[model samples]
Target: MLTVKRLDIADARILIKGASEKANEIGVPMCIAITDESGNLIAFERMDGGKVSSAFVAQDKAFTAAAARKATHEYNAANVPGNLAFGIHTEVGGKLSTVGGGLPVVVDGDVVGGIGLSSGTPQQDMDCAQAGIDYFLQNRG
Candidate 1:
């Protein structure tokens, strides 16, 4: 038998709340996505004025983070031309992202989920995603 840990709906809400707060603070409405360890969607939010096209992008980012167990930015770094890892974003039906807005949610050194944000510059999105993970860590009791 195998045991697995994953995020639930309440956890997803916490991630969204934290990410949205950061987005509001940064004056960038965003689309936030939370996914289970297996990259299954748990919850999603599109803040007011968030770009409609970003909805799916945020989800894909989260999927890449959770399923790959690494931040999307890390992939971006390794996905440059002539690198063996290049073109990885073309995998998983083009769902894998090399963008900077995706982060794996880790608890006790275990990746339990992921958070992703879009509708802003990549740096802003990355900040919001980190904020979500910070909030989850501080409030997951």
Candidate 2:
């Protein structure tokens, strides 16, 4: 049987810090969340000026990414047009956001968690997420 490694609180904190730094650099507050492979929340943070509502949105995005084992944006884009699964997000308790800022957190090339960021423009959100991922990869080993 194949075994998988999961992200821990430390990992989540690292990602969150990276995301927060990026958001601060861009002068945008952000809400960031991390979830396990089963879509359970691991850790989360909301910047001082972040939208209060974005906290839930970040959790939803992380849950959707981890549960689907794919970046939410990719799922959204791939399932558009003739794909019935495109609506799956709606059925998943409406906890999914097909936006660009949610990404699966992979370890050993396998998705073990997810990271989600909100409270910025879509592109800025994505950039913050990317910064977090980059930090994880750089410091993980």
Candidate 3:
């Protein structure tokens, strides 16, 4: 038998809160998404003024992070033409993302979930996603 850790709704909300704060700090309204270890969404938020197109993108980012257990940017870095992973973005019914905003949420060396943000530049989105993880680590009690 195998045991797995997953994120609850409360954990999902914390991720969204931290990511949103960073987005606000950076002056970008964002779409934030949180997913359990299997890439199932737990919570999502679209701030006022956030781009509508970013909604699904954020979810896809979160799914990639959680299911792949890696930051989406790492995939982006290795997705160059002629690379074996080049077509990964088209996998999983086009749900996998090679963008910079998705990060796995690790707890005690185990990935418990994922966080993803969109509506800003890829770098900005990555920053907010990282901020969300930092905040969750500090406040996971």
In order, what is each prediction's RMSD in angstroms?
0.6, 1.6, 0.7
lDDT of all predictions: 0.95, 0.86, 0.94
Q: Model 3, residue 119: displacement in angstroms?
A: 0.5
Instruction: Report the candidate with higher lDDT, 1 versus 3.
Output: 1
Backbone clash count for every predicted candidate, in the order shown? 0, 0, 0
Q: Which pairs of residues clash in candidate 3, taking residues 3 or more apart in a chain or in different chains? A: none
After best superposition, candidate 3 residue 6: deviation in angstroms? 0.7
lDDT by residue for model 1 (9-120), tens: 9999999999999999999999999999999899999999999989999999999999999999999999999999999999999999999999999988889998999999
TM for every model, in the order presented, reads 0.98, 0.91, 0.98
Judging by lDDT against the true structure, name the best candidate: 1
lDDT of 2 by residue, 118-138 (tens): 999878888998899889888
Question: Would you list the clashing residue pairs of candidate 1?
Answer: none
lDDT of 3 by residue, 42-104 (tens): 999999999999999999999999999999999999899999888888999999999999999
Off by over 4 Å in 1: none
Full-model lDDT, candidate 3: 0.94
Better of 1 and 2 by TM-score: 1
Please give the lDDT score at residue 35 for candidate 1: 96
